[model samples]
Target: MAWHDRAPDSFTATLWDGIGDVWAEIRAHPFLTGLKDGTLDHRAFVFYVIQDAHYLREYARALAVCGARANDVAGIRMFCEHAAGAIAVERELHESFFADFGLSEADVAATPMAPTNVAYTSYLLSAAYGGSYAEAVGAVLPCYWIYAEVGRELLAAGSPDSRYQRWIDTYGGEEFAEVVSQVLDAADAVGPSLSEADRAAAAHRFTTTSRYEWMFWEMGLRRETWPV
Candidate 1:
């Protein structure tokens, strides 16, 4: 089968398909359940948004690097468009978040970075800069896909007027969907170009990034030290 044809099901594509199942269970203490319900306090919400905004900056930077690495004008154009789109939508989303949190952009920009935040951003940057464009997409797609899926779910689970709804709406909207579609299409196209090892690597990178994404959210919800 083609590499793309061999990609995992939804369950398996999310990080080795349950390596962290035990940890996830343990981490799901009742307090952590608060996060599931989106009942985060103002401070936690602000912290999450601040850290998230910083991540978004790196997201664009990674996409740009990946575009250059692709060495194809069409690929580069897609990445550039994705980067511009991220800047427009994510920054505006962050601004809205800042307003919700009563924080200024400077305030969020100045906030301290957690280890998970740094590590996750670094992974994408490294992948984009040091690895091939296919690999870079592998690293970055999880963040976009996970947020879009989860955000859409969150919106469906409750009243549409909640503060959390706004957050979900921003990323779960059509603009973000377009980005996901673009990236996935890119992935499908690029998969055929990769060798077996590279294809496996891309798939692995994607799954790993997805797990980290879950942890990042869990950490933010837990309001604890950033989980690895």
Candidate 2:
């Protein structure tokens, strides 16, 4: 069977279809499994949240770059909203988790970026600065798409821990799903007009970022730190 058997006919869908193994790996990742069952360590969860806070700051900047480069008013406005929402709304979620986890602002600020976090955000920033609009969108899409999917899956399985449940509900709720849908719509609008080379680049960005998504979860599970 195809990876994205039910996916609609669009570049994002095609990119997703081509990355079956990566998606499966993400779904089966120990971090996600532990999260689903509420068996994950609190320290590990805290580490994940800290690293994610760092990631979101850079992600928001990349989104702003995308907005600045967008050709259409709607695309520009959509990306601007997304950029603001990432910082305003998602960062607020992180702040709430920080309080629950006993993580101070200084603690999060002092947290060094793991190798994987650095690589993932660097790739995104590079794409945003150097690639076309489609490529930028593709690079960022996996973050939203994967989290939304994982959130729904974990929520359905039911977390025994309220902390874990809160995290799950934030991403799994209808509001976040709508955000993902808006992003998908933006990608589809730009996809059909992309040149063949641009399309290929966008697919590569999508696939590469999807791998990073899995690595991100693994980084969290390990509470990854700089090896040096």
Candidate 3:
């Protein structure tokens, strides 16, 4: 079986398969290929890092909401703590990049969210705040799952650029994989309880976000901007 098909659980397996096309496109995206080989443009990487910092803030909020809606103590603890980790842990990396590039808070503030980033984050926030825990989980899962998968793959390929290597190491490392597993386990735990409608809704959420994950890479690769 392909690596993408080797999901952690049956529920996650379905979610994984549901968007196979998106996954293929992600795998084929120039941004990812360039990243693996250290050929990606510095401008694209910079654009991605800034947009990601913004994304993580909104993601933390969605996660906190997931924690609030969690039915179990474990789920609550995981979501809430992971929420903190998103900001604290990931922000450290972003901050270092900011320093390297001589960017200040004011600089980040002045940078507009690319249209795709805006749409994607808005979709995530809506799913998180307007839906059930399962729904929120579905929406957020692709970010965890795809990054870990890509990170590991890219790490194995190895980049010549230490800058890209650092990112590859961060996501591809065991720590991030463990984080992905926890979320997959959560999906499995809740899978059986979801009603048919809820399950379908969650599935839709997964597919949609998975596509956004691809578009995100495309946005960075192309250096997307507002036409108006």
Candidate 4:
């Protein structure tokens, strides 16, 4: 059966489709286009990537917990596997990025979280602890899905043959595809049955999350700084 078929109902499918649509739109946004094409400044964007990498393990662990709560053995396995992959990728990517740019983990960690950064992490943790596995997936899809789309667009837009290629390659590659597919499938399994009010609440959460994603790119370009 198709991975999506494992989803219990159409509600879950709709949620995943909605999340994917949001991500695709973000990819095509001009703001992100400029950022990825190197038309924008680098410090904030670089800081975002490195600091965000530090949180991947937390994100993955939360997903695993949610999956287990839902009795989703496959979900648990997928999150665990994906987390392992993130560990290796994060190590390699961060080290390379620091070496290439003459930065360090302290630089990124000491940089206070941008509003967008905090929003992204907050939404994930909130959804993971307070929502279902499907909800958690919905909350997290923006990052992975948006990066993949942005990676493709950046490449098409003639992103240089530089270290940025690693960022593009990591997100645009087969590995990320699998991670996204699994996340979407998990979202597809959780039917969105909240009442109209509940749906409105959920939609609000998602929209806010999407908006924060844009803010993240903006922060990158602005080189927004904050206290540690």
- The alpha-carbon lDDT assigned to residue 214 of candidate 3 equals 97
The C-alpha stretches of model 3 lying farther than 4 A from their native spots are 1-9
Q: What TM-score fits each model?
A: 0.80, 0.95, 0.95, 0.76
Ranking by lDDT: 3, 2, 1, 4
Clash count, candidate 2? 0
lDDT of 3: 0.89
Off by over 4 Å in 1: 1-38, 159-161, 224-228
After TM-score superposition, the amount by which residue 1's alpha carbon in candidate 3 deviates from its true location, in angstroms, is 16
Superpose all Cα atoms of candidate 3 onto the true structure and report the RMSD in Å to 1 decimal. Answer: 2.1
What lDDT score belongs to each candidate, Candidate 1 first? 0.68, 0.88, 0.89, 0.61
Candidate 2 deviant stretches above 4 angstroms: 1-7
Q: Could you give candidate 1's per-residue lDDT for residues 1-228 as a string of tens digits?
A: 221122564322433343345334434543234434766566666677777887788889998887777657887898887788777867887788788768887787677778888888888898888776677888887777666665555556643336666776765577666666666666666765668788777777776677678667655755556346
Q: Is candidate 1 or candidate 3 better by lDDT?
A: 3
The clash count of every prediction, one per candidate, is: 0, 0, 0, 0
Candidate 4 TM-score, C-alpha based: 0.76
Query: Candidate 3's residue-wise lDDT over 170-196, tens digit each?
Result: 999988888888888888889989898
Q: Which 10-residue span in candidate 2 carries the lowest summed lDDT?
A: 1-10
Residue-level lDDT for 118 in candidate 2: 99
Q: What is the lDDT of residue 205 in candidate 1?
A: 76
